[model samples]
Target: MYFRLEDKESYKSQEIGNLIRAYNRSKREEAESEPLNLYVEDEKGNLLAGLIAETFGNWLEIEYLFVKEELRGQGIGSKLLQQAETEAKNRNCRFAFVNTYQFQAPDFYKRHGYKEVFALQDYPYIGQRYYYQKNL
Candidate 1:
């Protein structure tokens, strides 16, 4: 067999996801079976912050978290994170993990009780990607 790196956008992503799910389902039948999205909206119903996460066994993986620039530094991100954690705990999640880039909110996660577990430098660009976890 031969392998090459190529980007085919959505098609390629879906193909890889299907392959991995098939492989992992054989090992753990319920890994990431139910994904969740949590969001906050302003009075005008515009989205201010959101988090996309999923559970694997007893752990929660936060895939994405974003807050509007106008809402930053106002504790909205912190409140959203706390609400996500509360929901995860309700689902019996014992720990949670998230990854953020160096230019992103590493310090914010740290303040929210997440500890950096690993760091990969020059990933996807010139900055570092930080992996963090917290015990619920």
Candidate 2:
């Protein structure tokens, strides 16, 4: 057998993810996972902001939350987060989890009641990575 690193968009990367997901599903028959992606677009259909997440079992795992640089500080991120949390709750999710870097929006998640559960220091040899969670 051989192993090779592949770009994130490659079919091999997708196959690896599918294999892991299949194994996980086989282990947890009750687990129901689904994507919970939200996006904001301009009138011209241009992308502005987005929140990507997934729900499985009783938890919502936030993968990414991004807003245009110019649109930052205008509450677009908060709005997207709030909407995702609401939808997760409606789907019977009991908790939400997210991770952010020191230079990223750690305080934003905290402001939304997500508590820091762990921190990895010296991530990227300069900054920290923070893991946060909130009860829904």
Residue-level lDDT of model 1, residues 55-80, one tens digit each, is 77788889999998877988888877
Candidate 1 residue-wise lDDT at 123: 92
TM-score of candidate 1 relative to the true fold: 0.86
Which regions of candidate 2 fall more than 4 Å away from where they truly are? 1-19
Model 1 spans > 4 angstroms off: 1-7, 10-13
What's the lDDT for all of these models? 0.87, 0.95
For candidate 2, lDDT tens digit of each residue in 13-123?
A: 789899998898788768788999999999999999999999988999999999999999999999999999999999999999999998999999999999999999999
The weakest ten consecutive residues by lDDT in model 1 span 27-36
Clashing pairs in 1: none
